[model samples]
Target: MIDQDHKLGVKEANLVSRKLQLSGIQGQEAEALVAEIEQQFGVDRVAYDPDAGTLAFSYDATHCNLDLVESILSKRGAGFATNWWNRTKRSYYRYVDQNIKDNAGYEPHCCNKVPRK
Candidate 1:
């Protein structure tokens, strides 16, 4: 299990660890690095499914409605794929604005789709 004190939640911790791995940090040290982030950010919920290679996080359970998570998983493949990183490079504010505009009245559901490996 991941360290709960880390503020990054589950998904962000996983993403940070992955990025560290890509940058040459591996094994326990990588885990520690992510934990540090969690301590700083204060994650409320985190889920890492090795089978799907996905990491998910939310500030609180209520904020992470099932349908929204399912939408993110469906739209983006498991793990931090190349496309996922690429999308992050676009204007951060733009995505936030778009998400706000698009997600109005959107009700999320739990994902029942087959997990990716």
Candidate 2:
């Protein structure tokens, strides 16, 4: 018999692990993206597997949302899953992104001015 309880409390949570369809993305590129998310986006963490072409990221909803994250990746010419839900998400993010840009005193997550160790 198949078990349905195994799927409990997954997407209902704040942290969602949506994988992007980054075709032929390399390890170095993935690492660089990770660094970008951490340094510029203020993402708490990111897990990218070049072989699988998947990236799992976690951010504080209070500070920033996934739409902003997508905006950054979109700027890098990265592609995302073509699923209906993801597609809808991308669209919504686009709207939020514009508002973020238009709003005054609204800094985009973090900055790159920090000195490297």
Candidate 3:
């Protein structure tokens, strides 16, 4: 696990990192976007590399996911690049986030804890 402090309301076990190549981000204006994302409930960390046009962030999948982040980006006139790799990754991210959410409340019911003779 990465040695870093997560933001309030973030669960370490549900933490997830995402790195996306974004389009239409104005230089310096990304700071506003970053600030907005940081204010979200489960966002742990966020950074935008203007030169690479990439946005990297970590959040608790149980509370925040890519869709929420994308909404904020869309409102700010930024979005993921339209490319095969990006699309594939975005789909995977969504799948994993959904899975995490689905399983967040699940509990294992195994008998391994029973005392042996």
Candidate 4:
């Protein structure tokens, strides 16, 4: 017997991220970095500034976790210009963001999604 179901389509929202400072990731080098990140499953959009050494990206929180994003940079040898303390905090945030996404099964960083009354 053939199964029948209606309304099978699902809609997912794109999540945007704040400017993430990356050291030595500006200019031509950024092209490769962006290309690699773009290939990831969660990544939807990316913006890189050559002078400021920052990258902004959009991704699906579930499939694309924070560590995953950092992993891309770390493995590529892209350093963070910030001091140790800030780096630690940023790392912590990434962990928390991943947890939030996994728990809710929603977009990453939860705050990006506007609340509905």
Top TM-score: which candidate number?
3
Task: Select the stronger candidate by lDDT from 1 and 4.
Answer: 4
In model 4, which regions exceed 4 Å deviation?
Answer: 1-16, 84-89, 105-117
- On TM-score, the stronger of 1 and 3 is 3
10-89, model 1: which lDDT tens digit per residue? 34322221110022233454344344333433235444544444444443221233234333434433223445553463
Candidate 3 Cα misplacement greater than 4 A, ranges: 1-4, 112-117
Candidate 2 lDDT, tens digit per residue, 8-113? 2212223333445554356677777777876643355678877667777754343556766666677677757677866786677556544543563455655767
**Model 2 poorest ten-residue lDDT run:** 1-10
lDDT of 3 by residue, 44-91 (tens): 999999889999999999999999999998999889999999999999
- Score every model by TM-score: 0.29, 0.52, 0.89, 0.64
Prediction RMSDs, each to the true structure: 14.7, 14.4, 3.6, 10.9
lDDT: which candidate is best? 3
Query: Model 1 misses residue 74 by how many Å?
Result: 24
Clashes of 4: 0
| Total clashing pairs for each candidate | 14, 0, 0, 0
> Candidates 2 and 4: which is better by lDDT?
4
The digit string of per-residue lDDT tens for model 4 on 1-117 reads: 111221112114324354567885647778888889878875666778876667777666656666777888888788666878658867776876667566665445577778877
For candidate 2, report its TM-score.
0.52
Lowest lDDT block of 10, candidate 1: 15-24
lDDT of 2 at 33: 76
Instruction: Mark the 10 consecutive residues where model 3 has the least summed lDDT.
Output: 1-10
- The models' CA-based lDDT, in order, is 0.38, 0.57, 0.92, 0.65
